[model samples]
Target: MASKTLSNSLVRHLMKRGYAQAAPARSETIQTSVLPNKTFIAGVDTNSPVARVTVAFRAGSRYEPQTELGVSHVLRSAAGLTTGCASSFIIARKLAQIGASVSASGDREFVYYTLEATQDNLQDAVEILASLISRQEFRPWELSDNVPRLKYELAALYPQVRAVDLLHKAAYRRGLGNSLFISPKRIGKISSESLQHFAGANLTAARCAVVVVGDNQDKAALVANCLQLTGLGEESKAEGSKYYGGELRKEMGGDLAHVAIALQGAPASSPASLALAVAAKALGNGPVTKWGADNSVLAKAIGNIGPFAAAGFNVSYSDSGLFGAVLSVPKDEANCAVKAVAGVLKKGGLSADAIRAGKNQLKLQILSEAEAGTSLAESVAAQGLTTGNVLPPATLAAAVEQINESTVNQALASAAQSKISMGAAGNLAFVPYVDEV
Candidate 1:
């Protein structure tokens, strides 16, 4: 009866600790590790039919040297070009046969390539992904042919998008100030050699991370281990982004004016960043429900400014961040709306109710985004790039829960006291300069 006695004693110990009735404190499903070749890999089991794998690099537009200003944007469009091991036709055919797809996207701080397929077909998807990431051959002819498409993309950009770009320009002025899209002037000027050189310097295998969701961790690690990226170099560390508060305005002569005002925010992965995020939401994001009236402090302050839209915006990068509000209003209402937004930002007050609402809303947004696998994969990969680790939605939500009211108010107070920068586009006659506002 020795084994029976031992089992009885274990049961008694568990009961004493109150572990049987309640769930364990955590069930860590996300796993991250670095391969021998120095590539970071993160995997999570979603138990879903669709599986996704992402290869993310510190090859964003900001990483471009002064000589290669818009190369990252060009590189984003150069996905699926002929690689060393496969032609365009063969890659497309294989992907179509396997019912999989691959796409590329870039931002200020990262370039992401993602492949999606079912779990059973993930191996095939990995092969296709490898060809794209490890064997890119940016041929001269192919690069030239991409110009028209790039021009079309530039033409299709919305004016508000331009306003956001200008905001970045005025904020940091060089590194983080770079645009996410290629400028029209830079199109066709970026050559194959430039693209290859940029990749060789910034998009190295060691500088990237492969993040897989809805798959076995072991299998995903094996898949990541097989990736042999040709580009090899340590990515240049991001230069410290210093904030310069100033104004950038472009007159598009449209009926609506788009304006963004911001203060220097906290770095990514900092408690201050999370606090600032909660403050952004507290300041007001958007309507709570469809067509619902926003009860946000800013909304209540701007009461009935005709035909206008406004929301707080917060984006955090590895070293620095930006937090503020963006307002779009009719030309007739621009003056009044702009002042009201500026006034609200200047106040930067947070209430108990607002903090509770903001924390709850941010938690819901992150959790919802995680359920949509593509966004979650991108997010995890970005975390993997900067922090060298990833946490699941459950743990992230817990983090939100841990942000007390004091912390949120402290971050807001700090940002509010800092000088603000303003960016405006479309029908600028009514929009005031930063000093005027």
Candidate 2:
């Protein structure tokens, strides 16, 4: 009886001091600030054991000049290579010793480098991340060694990705239209000097942001201070992309027809972008649950035609965006499916129940992504870089609450009236062009 009493007392003590493992409180909100040098930083301390920090820059493909088309792809491949202070061997050996990992990813608008580690090791990991982002030294032989990786990534592009790449090309014609992957013709031709020039011109403090998830705001401030890298000049202005409605089609033999038809949508900075996001959900995305066939309106409308896949696709850049749906149908079903999907996009009207369902789904998506550290960091960084302001998931969901039926309807109307652009690949013999759609 005395031993049992002592054990009960010890359990109470541990629980009081937070020694017992438990989920962190969700009441804590996101914190954001900017460094003196103009680098943005944000943090959401869930008081969890794992942590993530990201350094992002407006140094993506859209910023690349006409002379350097594929530098960003090569730049992503160059992560973990030699920096000014540490060799790739040392970076790898030390990070592995600490059991931490880092990654690099990019799109048309920005490039992000993220570091992940246990909460205790995050400070040390930040030091290495600082070196990686600020002290990049693009060596000639090292870049040449990475050509195979570049080729492999490009080779891995299947029909869907190829179609999307062409879709961007048709929509913007340039700038936002730049391909995320290296063009096959430009492979092995991009020079080290080109990369150095692009980095030197674009990765400036004005264009950089640091975002930390799973840690405190003070830690985020420290991380941003550490990344106040100099030497890169002020943000270099890139030519603005104007939407030019056109078609890009690839004639290839295949059983499926992959296509994306779109019109210019609201920019990420605009209030309508969120409603457009909700509309994308309303338009439908295949299946939400496991082992279940899709019940979305798009699926039901086109599913009867043949076995195929259809989903809404919305991409918002800093100043431009694309709103449309993609359809992949058997070549034999392409004629009807393509025209039907395009007609739906151009029609742009949804019922109140559909809008409500879309808002709920989007809210769930936003909150769920916040719980994912990498995605959370990406969201914070992108929001910071593009708008110079960051909204936590909770606040963002609240903003979604402000969106009503009329808001989404107006966004859809605006998009419908915009000129049309289309991209098609894989057995294009049956797919319709923009004019036909």
Candidate 3:
């Protein structure tokens, strides 16, 4: 009897493991429901003890009106201030008692409130998130108190960080061009009234979603219901962004030089966006280890240009995208690598072997990130906002598999023809002009 039981258990384990290896598509399961108030909920029951929930609003820096610039940044910093139901201290205490961790962040596209806690505390977590978003008290004193914190945080941005910010300004110049961090100059201009008005107009049910990654389906559903009852306003879309590629340059003190060159790419909803992602993978996405070497096309092309580090990226938004490479090198050696990078961009060619390798790497990265709790929740919320649902892993794999040499060449060629959005910060004398590249 004992021998028979042991054999059965071994067979069961092998069957589960073998099936997962044989069919990766079946490994991910998603359940989605849209509430009567137009609040969307995407839930994945991973059966893990720890859970993550995020309420994502379409409110972001890009949505800020001209008169209310930097209000989104202030709103993010003031996430848990005094709500209608509870003070900031009481809110924090409640979450602490339930052993939950919470944070809020804003970007060019969205602002999200994320809560991480045990499955048992999920209900309390949801209530806290709902209260924080709907009942946020935009008192003048509370808003003023967080301004110094924002200033201190903004001061810590390094040259590389500043260069990326300048890159967007060079690329879009307006909507998507909005800075992710609040400018110190504009911080004083933002007022509590502006934040309250911004939240009233943008933080509505039509533009929000609740995403959960955990084992308890019941608690997630309850959270969704709680959000619907908040009576948030109707959804309103932001103005579409137009890409007019130009150049932005700034001189700073660092001995190293930072440069970003970008051209117009495809939007997030476009099928060509998948091809661009695959092309980026082939170009290079950084090395796996500190000591590991990258042998991608871009890496090999610039190998003789002197000691420098570079990575290719494809930044997609709802309406537009920026595809390019960012390079960092010694001040004296910057231009040499920039020329090499431009040459590689103009000739964007990919072999069959490289395409296959890129597909595998992209697949691995997507699946690996989905395995984490908070990451999966964020993915669900962000994708739900964009496409009304998340793209399954298998669908993503299929899209990537269809990419070929011609597809990559065409994507890069289009970018090359567009006006280049160029940025250089630190040791500006050695940085090349956009036309020169």
Best by lDDT: 2
Candidate 2 residue lDDT tens string, 1-437: 00111122221221110100011113358778887777787888877788888888888888888887888898898998899989999999989988899999988878999999998888788899888887889888888788888889987766766777788899887898998888879887888788877887877777887877888778888887777577435556755889987889988787888887888887877777788888877876666654566766667567577667776767777787888777678888888888888888888777788788888877776676566778678767887777777655566778777889999999999999998888888998888778887
RMSD to true structure for each model, in Å: 11.8, 10.6, 9.4
| Tens digits of per-residue lDDT for model 3, 39-113 | 778777777888888888888778877666678888888888999989999999999999998888866778888
Can you give the lDDT of residue 34 in candidate 1?
83
How does candidate 3 fare on TM-score? 0.89
What value of lDDT does candidate 2 attain over all alpha carbons?
0.76
Candidate 2 residue pairs in backbone clash: none
User: How accurate locally is residue 271 in candidate 3, as Cα lDDT from 0 to 100?
Assistant: 66
Off by over 4 Å in 3: 1-26, 215-221, 228-237
Clashing pairs in 1: none
Per-residue CA lDDT of model 1 for 4-114, tens digit only, reads: 111222212211101001111113387788877777887777787989888898899888887778899999899998999898889999999989999998778889999
**Cα lDDT for residue 121, model 1?**
87
Write down the lDDT of every candidate, Cα atoms only. Answer: 0.75, 0.76, 0.71
Give the distance in Å from residue 348's predicted Cα in candidate 3 to where it truly belongs. Answer: 3.6
Question: Any idea what lDDT model 1 has?
Answer: 0.75
